[model samples]
Target: MPDSASDVFDIPADVLQRETARIFRGHGLLPNDADWVAEALVEADLRGIHSHGVTRVPIYTERLARGLFNPRPNVCVVRQGPSVVSVDGDNGMGAVVGRRAVAAAVDVVAETGCAAVGVRNSNHFGIAALYAEQLVAHGFIALVCSNAPPTMAPHGGRSALFGTNPLAFGVPAPGERQILADMATSIVARGKIILAQQRGEEIPLGWALDPDGRPTKDAATALNGVVLPFGGAKGSAIALLVDILAAVMTGAGFGTDLPDFYNDLDRPGNLGHFLLAIDPARFGERDRFLERLGRYINMIGDCPPAEGFERVQLPGEVEAGLRRKHLSSGVPLSQDILLGLRQAAGHADVSLEL
Candidate 1:
């Protein structure tokens, strides 16, 4: 659900962060873990990806309270080889598991020049870009993949059999931001449709199909149906690849075996994620690599704009721009979403005025 200025309320990032952490802490998460999770969600909000931001607080806290997700778990990292490791999240919060996994990857990458970390038994980790950005900040190229609960159908099939599996990649770029690409394989993330449904808004055609396999704009119907994959077969194929690496290889649930994060309260999500990090200096001089990468980025940026479009922008450029602007102004939240957040805060006995 896209937000318009007329229907939004601005909350300063720092204030939102404090309140969100309080809510999580009130719900039983350890103070440090709650703070980290709050920062992660707020970072997404600052970047304008509200679907994965604070809007998720209600469902997340609900699941936590219901004991569907672990508020605290002993995340274990097992080193399989010189550069390979495995993580067992013990049914922990996905972002918490992801934070630990990425930290292990960073250490491995520092030791071996590259790392491959497989994670299992985790819940929904919001925004893969968070880990990618962290790796990029360490001057390492990163590829992050996560297998979610199934929401999309296999190519040519009408049943929901595939996750809107997401993939993210990031590398250090000249100046401020990294060259980052993060996306769900579906035509749109299921969260957007969920948001639309929550707001009683209609979705766009081609985003999903009704149960009868007919295209529909009704968000509720779409949720009952299946989301379409982007680029049809191509996206479906990529989704399968992500599932293989993130779920199958990591010993997590796949296909229908994966429980829905929103509807399945009886079991843990048992989701999986894979992270790969490569130090650029592993192959050549770090300065030379940076210089060449800068030149390539400049070439892309200087490309002529196509009709109805501005000059070429790197992947994540728009989100980065929004982040900078929102840091000073504030993150925008729809009225409905704000109300929901407040209600969630109340449930945890945490007062939230924003």
Candidate 2:
């Protein structure tokens, strides 16, 4: 059933986690890996970014069953320099590989006050904010970028030539509220289009082009077509930068050779991610910096609203509020995604409730 905008759906957070864990375990993921993956998916839902939430569980399970993803592959730091490290994911689950990379970056930054880590051969690791927030919790500023399978075309091109190329940045604050910005270079992330298709809704024009290279609003057709960059040349330029940093710099798959995260089971996806962690204390007095940040934030917040707007919000503020509300209530799932999850569970010999 399609959910009405005002209609609320609620499930206990623990129940949602357990359901996800069950789904992952049934797909042959180890207990620890299942837990971490479940947490990441749930975190996305809590933050109201349903595109990266449990809706993707079925896809992940399908990839696992098709032998396209390894549930028990090795993840190791292959090379380490003074302030840089490279990790090989060995076709493992992306949640595991991504977490390991973040952990390594955290460790390096703790010692060197700054560190950059590149990971290759990983899978879809969900929201970039998850990794950035991890570093934020440790009082370090974090920047993360990932290269996806090519679904976006570069400027002046008619065919797909670049990945959506997501980027995320996070900074720790004095209080519980951390500042974060996460977005895809495209006009819309593929996950959002997927969600629209699943919900049988039409997307806005200019969001994507049909396979024949014409503007389209049909979500299903858009999936086969190319997603436009956010601001034309500017977004396309950023996508190129992400490709350089996340794919070329890390020696992972790039451009047309990037593996499709959804299908194509023949080869390893070789998704690449780049992460940086920087300790504020190393640059100046931490207390003073935070104080200044707080003041700046207040100034932004105190700006007068325009038209029907009530207030201004800093990056991540809306998401943080949504997360708090969802945690107490429940993360809403579209009926289509719910059915897909049930089907995946059945295939894995696992049971799902509603």
Candidate 3:
């Protein structure tokens, strides 16, 4: 363990994945589904997004055991066109549903030079970047969006009326580096607030509002309240666009109609996601595209920093740096998260060494 007060103990990435898989399998998920789900969660943790990491394992396990989620959903491609496809998640794990959609999109793009896919009846798919990165690895530009449970309010509306609605974009670079941008439309993701609450910490004033719509530092109250949009109206507009494209376009539940990921375990959460893959070679020379991208990145990196700042990083640079550091050092597993995983393992009849 690191001596720093803010630092956390790092566990090997494979250990975390095994533990996660064990817990999920205990809850009745098939071995393959459990492996994919665990991989996605562990990958998120490795990328430094602790909010969506193993901390969520217990909740997922409990939901699955309680019959809130279908452990063996028959996820299938429901419709197919030359450039477009649609999938029915059949209430299966979100990671499985998301991977299937990305695979479908990649196959279509390979043949037609471009493809778009919409998925419905899925659960939370962890990080959107995971799917986008798949396309990036295949020499394609990827765009992904998903509609989440309502956590944000529409502009001028005091009640929660919209989802955080994350969007991800990824473009392959010349070398191993890829330009990836993944973020929620809200001022802060709901996962961060949940983490703060679990740690008994308070959040910044602007991250969320109180139940009465007043800014508050309390995480629990903010969980009940509404999260603020990223750029006020601009972010609200983006959230609306994501909801329409992911949910409405896919004929999934929209707005307040979506089920809660945790609390409501009786019904299937009709969540939706959209993925697009564009083959750069279709429009321009691959090398030329990469050269221009490299130039743009260099220009951004060369920008003069303000006082106390050292560099201007692209969207995924910080995450990539953190991932590199954590991969070698280990991933941090908080006591609370560990306890949850242990409890989930016990419930699933799996013995966890941690």
Candidate 4:
């Protein structure tokens, strides 16, 4: 349960997971599938990434009720080559579909030492890190990517043409959490804009441009505009690379063909995803690779910090730390989300027990 603070509650991780799983099941997902999706979103929240957390349950359930996606889809996998696989999600929930893809890739790598998996006709899969994390656990280095609806414009171009395509990587390690990096090519995720708009907050300039391609601070306006690409043209190029691999190769809808999940509730996203799993044993001794990987993480943390910062922080370190703290201290959630959860529970016929 959350505390008596100002419109805030600190829900425990297990409680949230149980309740969320129940809601998903009530919405037509099988028990196991519901649990998987619940874990994905709850993990995002535990890592302090509120943008991809349970706040999404409302919209997701609404879409579910509208029959935009298959609550129980038959995710089919086909071998493309000796070590390549392709998956058709049947318009399934991204979390469920992504897990199936990663699992298939891991299985292929188990037989071939390396694997590439392409996924198509899926909906918005949450964080890309989840798949990478899964592969790393199976002793494989992993790269994952997904294409989103249009949010970012090509460098020096005016309207949106490319998605805020995201990529993630996970390196294998023995005594460490492994090196994990997940990022959207855009300066920020559009979900952050939606969160800001809900909070009546202003967005930072330079993060996005208005519909006319001018910088804007209003979160709602910025959302209606184009999100900026990170590192200018370089990031735009990376985003294009992601789109080609995740969309073109996977045969999913690309660029603007994919409708926004929020704006067009009944339209299936038909998103694309890609995953690569490489065995460290193929390069050298697995033990040595793990040792070196752990060394690098320690060295990075040991570096002295610049002014205004206490120490160097790795890409996933902050979120990992937040996860550890929240697991014991309870997950802090806003009242608005709590209320929405209540509504979602009612719609799905799940008991929130608030």
Tens-place lDDT digits, model 2, residues 1-354? 456533446767788889898889999989989999999899999999889988888888888888888888789895478789999999888888999999999889989999999989898888999999999889899999999999998877768989999999999887765689999999999999987886789999999999999999999999999999999999999999988998899988999897777767677789999999999999999998899988888888799988998898778999999998988888886566677778989999998875
Order of candidate numbers by TM-score, starting with the best: 1, 4, 3, 2
lDDT, each prediction: 0.91, 0.88, 0.88, 0.89
What TM-scores do the predictions have? 0.96, 0.95, 0.96, 0.96
Worst 10 residues of 1 by lDDT: 1-10
How much does candidate 1 score in TM-score?
Answer: 0.96
Stretch of 10 with least lDDT, candidate 4: 1-10
Q: Each candidate: how many clashes?
A: 0, 0, 0, 1
Off by over 4 Å in 4: 1-6
Candidates ranked, most accurate by lDDT first: 1, 4, 2, 3
lDDT score, candidate 3, position 139: 93
For model 2 the local lDDT of residue 110 reads: 87
Q: Which pairs, if any, clash in model 4?
A: 2-10
| Tens-digit lDDT track of model 3 for 29-146 | 8898889999999989999999888988888887788777788889989547789999999988899889889888888988999998999989899999999999989999999999
- Candidate 1 residue pairs that clash: none
Better of 1 and 2 by lDDT: 1
User: What's the distance in Å from true for residue 90, model 3?
Assistant: 0.3
| Model 1 per-residue lDDT tens digits across residues 173-225 | 87764699999999999989997887788999999999999899999999999
